[model samples]
Target: MSSKQRFIKSVVATAKADAPAMPWARGARRAAFIAKRSGVEMDKKAA
Candidate 1:
């Protein structure tokens, strides 16, 4: 599978296996992952 798909699957698996203590924590994790992925895409485009 593609890296992006793998990453998403891993995230889903983690979410299912371990419940977050707070809803905001899950949101923060998702936001951070998106930010990180976007930064990588930007770098690829810039290159």
Candidate 2:
């Protein structure tokens, strides 16, 4: 799988395993993951 796809799958797996506390954390992770994958920095406005 591609890095991006792997990242997404991992995030989903994590979310499923830790649903309660994973909501915000999952969002944060996804934002950071997306930024890293796209070679861009995450901005507060976008987050």
Candidate 3:
């Protein structure tokens, strides 16, 4: 597999693995995972 594909696979795997039990917490965790992996700052909270 290509490097980019491998990265995506790993990202999904990690996101799934780190998901929380609660639905709301799971969504937050998923968002955090995406932001962290994409190297984007999540300083602003959603209103």
Candidate 4:
């Protein structure tokens, strides 16, 4: 096998853990994530 194939084989050999859930799972986390993503200043008391 070529070097690329060897690299892919190595990558596939490793068992990675499941990815974490999205940050928007909670109300506060969702608000903060949305504010950061949209470049807006969120008011905590407004909600």
Sorting all predicted structures by lDDT, with the top scorer first, yields 2, 3, 4, 1
Q: Who wins the lDDT comparison? A: 2
Over the stretch 1-47, how does candidate 4's per-residue lDDT look in tens digits? Answer: 99999998777665354455665565776787778899999887743
| Candidate number with the higher TM-score (3 or 4) | 3
Deviation from native of the Cα of residue 23 in model 3, angstroms: 14
Ranking by TM-score: 1, 2, 3, 4
Hey, what RMSD does candidate 2 come out at? 13.6
Model 1 lDDT tens row, 1-47: 99999999999999999976775556545656676887743333323
Model 3 C-alpha lDDT per residue in residues 11-34, reported as the tens digit of each score? 999998895577556666577777
lDDT of 3 at 8: 100
CA lDDT, every model vs. true structure: 0.69, 0.81, 0.76, 0.73
Residue 36 in model 1: lDDT: 82
Candidate 4: Cα lDDT at 15: 36
Name model 1 segments beyond 4 Å from true. Answer: 23-47
TM-score of each: 0.44, 0.40, 0.40, 0.34
Q: After superposition, which runs of candidate 2 have C-alpha atoms over 4 Å from their true positions? A: 22-47
Highest-TM-score candidate: 1
After superposition, the stretches of candidate 3 with alpha carbons farther than 4 Å from their true spots are 20-47
Candidate 2 lDDT tens digits, 1-47 = 89999999999999889757554567766887778899998877766
Error of 4 at 3 (Å): 50
Q: Residue 4 deviation, candidate 2, in Å?
A: 0.1
Off by over 4 Å in 4: 1-25, 45-47
CA lDDT for candidate 1? 0.69
Task: Report the alpha-carbon TM-score of model 2 versus the true structure.
Answer: 0.40
Candidate 4 global lDDT: 0.73
